[model samples]
Target: MSRITTVFDKLRQQNRKALIPFITAGDPEPALMVPLMHELVKAGADILELGVPFSDPMADGPTIQRSSERALKYGVGLKDVLSMVEEFRKDDTGTPVVLMGYANPVEAMGYETFAARAKASGIDGVLTVDYPPEESEEWVEHLNRQQIDAIFLLSPTTPQARVEQVAKMAQGYVYYVSLKGVTGAANLDLRDVADKLIRLRSRIPIPIGVGFGIRDSMAAKAVAELADAVVVGSRIIEEIENSAKENILTNVYRLVRSLRSAIDEAGSKH
Candidate 1:
C-alpha cells in the first residue's frame, strides 16, 4: 500500500480520522519550511499538503496568496520545494507529503520529469488544482508509474459523472471542498456538507477529506465526523501571517493541537 493508503487503513482500524494540515513551502520564511513540516507531524498531522508557491494562485484566498507571494519573493520554486521534501524525509519517512498547487509549474517541469523527481524526493501525492480528470489520463499514468498518488479535488458543484471519473483516476484520498468558493471562504453549513458527503460516499470508494471552510476546532470536528480527514490551510496561513517568526511554530502547533483534539473527540464519538 502507498503511505497514504497505509495511514488511512491504520486510522480506520483505530476509528480515527486523519488530520491533514497544509503549509505553503518557504512561507513565513524559507529557512523555516522543514522545521515547520516536522513541527506539524509532531502536532498530530497525519498527512501533510505542502503548497507550491505560484505567481497566480487562482484557487487560494488572500491568506494563501500572500503566503505564495512571500515564498516566491524568496525564489522558492518547485525544485526548492522538492529539496525541502528531501530534507524532511531524512527524519520523516512515515507521513505522506502531498504537493498542492497549480499546473503551470508542473508543465514547466514536465509531467514525467516532475513525477520522477517527486518520487525521488519522497513525495507521496500530487493535487494540481487545475488538472481535470478528463485531461489527466497521461499525467495520472506518469505519477502512478512512479507510485505517487495523483489526488484530485471534488467540490459541491462537481457533476456525478465527473465524480466517477475522478474516482477512477485519483489515488490517495479525494479532497472535498466544503464551501463553494475559494479557500478560506466562510459559512461552512455542515448540514449541506453532510448531505453532499452522503452522495460522495456512495460514489468515492477511497477516503474523503473535507477542507476550504473548516477554520476552527468546531467545524473541524463536525467535518471529521463525516469525512475521513480534515484539511486546514487558510486558518493556519492566517496564523503564520500574524505571528512573529520566533512564535510561528509554537502558534501553529497550538492551533493544530486544538483541531487535533476536537477531531479526536469526534472519532471517540464515532
Candidate 2:
C-alpha cells in the first residue's frame, strides 16, 4: 500500500480517527524542519501536511501568511522544501507527507516536472489551494502518472456537482474545509459538517478529513466523532510560535500529544 493508504487503512482497522498536523516548511529555520517533523510524528501525528511557502497564499489567514513570509525570507523555495523531504526519507519513511500550498511554484517548475520531482523526493501527495477541480485535470493526470495523489478540498458551501467533481479527482483522502473562509477564520458547525460528510460519503470512496478553525481538544474530539480525520493547523502553529523560545521540540511534543489523546478519546468511543 502507498504510505497514505497504509496510514488511513490502519486507522480504519482500529476504528480510529486520524490526527493530521500542518506545519510550514522552513519555519523558524530550514534546519529545524526535519527535527520538527520527527517531533510531530513522535507525538502521534497520523499524517503530516507540510505547507510550501508561497508569495500569495489567498486562502491562508494572518498566522499562516506570516509563516510563509518567514519561510520565504530565509530563501526557502519549492526545491529546498523537496530537498528536505528527500533527506527526511533517509531515516523516516513511514509517515505520509502531503505538500500543501499554492500552485504558482509548481507551475513555474512545470506540472510534470514538479510531480516527478515530488515522487522522487518521496512525497505522497499534493494539495494546491488555488487549483480547483476544473483546472486540475492535467495536473491530476501527471501526478497519477508519477504515483502521487492529487488532493482537493471541499468546502461547506460547495454544491453537490462540485463535490462530485472533487471526489472523482481527489486521491488519498479529501480535505473538507470546515468553513467557507481561510484557514483561521471562525464559525465551524461540526453537526452541519457531519451532515455534509454523510452526503459526500455516498459518492466519494475515500475518507474525509476536516480542517480550519479547530482550536482545542473539545473541538478536535467533536470533529473526530464525525469525520475520519481531524486536522489541526493554526492551533499547533500558534503553540509553536508561542513556545519556541522555551524549547521548540518539547512544546510541540506536548501539544501534539495532547491533541493525540483528544483524538484517541473520540476514536475509542466508536
Candidate 3:
C-alpha cells in the first residue's frame, strides 16, 4: 500500500482522525525546511503536506503567498523541495509527505519526470491547486504509474457532476476547501462542512480532509468530529511567520501538538 493509504488505514483502525499539517517547503529558509518537516511529525502529525513554492499561488491567501515569496527569494525550486524531502527521509521513513502547489512547476519539470523524482524522494501524494480533475487524465496516469497519489481539491461551490469526476480520478484523499475564499479566509461553518461531507462521502470512497481557516485546536477538533482528517495550513504558516528562526521549530511543534491532542480527544469518542 502507498504510505498515504497505509497511514489513513492505520488511523481508521485506531479510530483516530488524521492530523495533517502543511508547510511551504523551503519556507523560512532551505536550511530549516527538512528540520521543520521532522518537527511536524514529532509534534504528532499523521501526514505532512509540503508546499512547493509557486510564483502565482492564487488559491493561497496572504500567509501562504508570503511563504512562497520567502522561499523563492532564496531561489528554491521544485527540485529543491524534492531534495529537502529526500534529506528528511534519511531520518524518518514512515510519515507520508504530500506536495501541495500550483501546476506550472510540474508542467515545467514534465509530469513523468516529476513523478519519478517525487517517488524517488519519498513523496506519497500531490495536490496541484489548478489541476482540475477533468483535464488531469494524463497527469493522473503518470502518478498512478509511479504509485503516487494525485490528490485534488473540492470547494463548496463544486457541482455533483464535478465531484463525481474528481472521485473517479483522485487518489489518496480529496481536500475539501471549507471556505469559498482562499486559504486564509475565515467564517468556517462546521455544520455546513459536515453537511457537505455527508454527501461527498457517499460518492467518494476515499477519506475527506477539510482545510482553510482551520486556525486552532478548537477548529481542528470540530472538523475532526466529522471529516476523516483535519488539515491545518495557514495557521501553521502564521506560527512560522511570527516566530524567530531559533524558535520556529519549537513554536510550530507546540501548536501542532495541541491540535493533535484536540483531534485525538474527538477521535476517542468515535
- Pairs that clash in candidate 2: none
lDDT of each: 0.94, 0.89, 0.92
Off by over 4 Å in 3: 267-270
What is the per-residue lDDT of model 3 for residues 180-237, given as tens digits with 9 covering 90 to 100? 8989788898889988988898999998899999988899999998899999999999
Q: Between the candidate structures 1 and 3, which one is better when assessed by lDDT?
A: 1
Instruction: Summing lDDT over every window of 10 consecutive residues in candidate 1, give the lowest-scoring window.
Output: 261-270
Q: Candidate 2: lDDT of 54?
A: 93
* Model 2 bad stretches (over 4 Å): 267-270
Model 3, residue 230: displacement in angstroms?
0.6
Cα displacement (angstroms), candidate 2, residue 21, comes to 0.2
lDDT tens readout by residue for model 2, 1-270: 679999999998898899999999998789989999999999999999999999999999988988899899999999999999998888798999999999899999999889989999999999999899889889899999989988899988899988877878889999999987889777877788878878887878998889999988889988898888889998788877787455988998998899889988894433
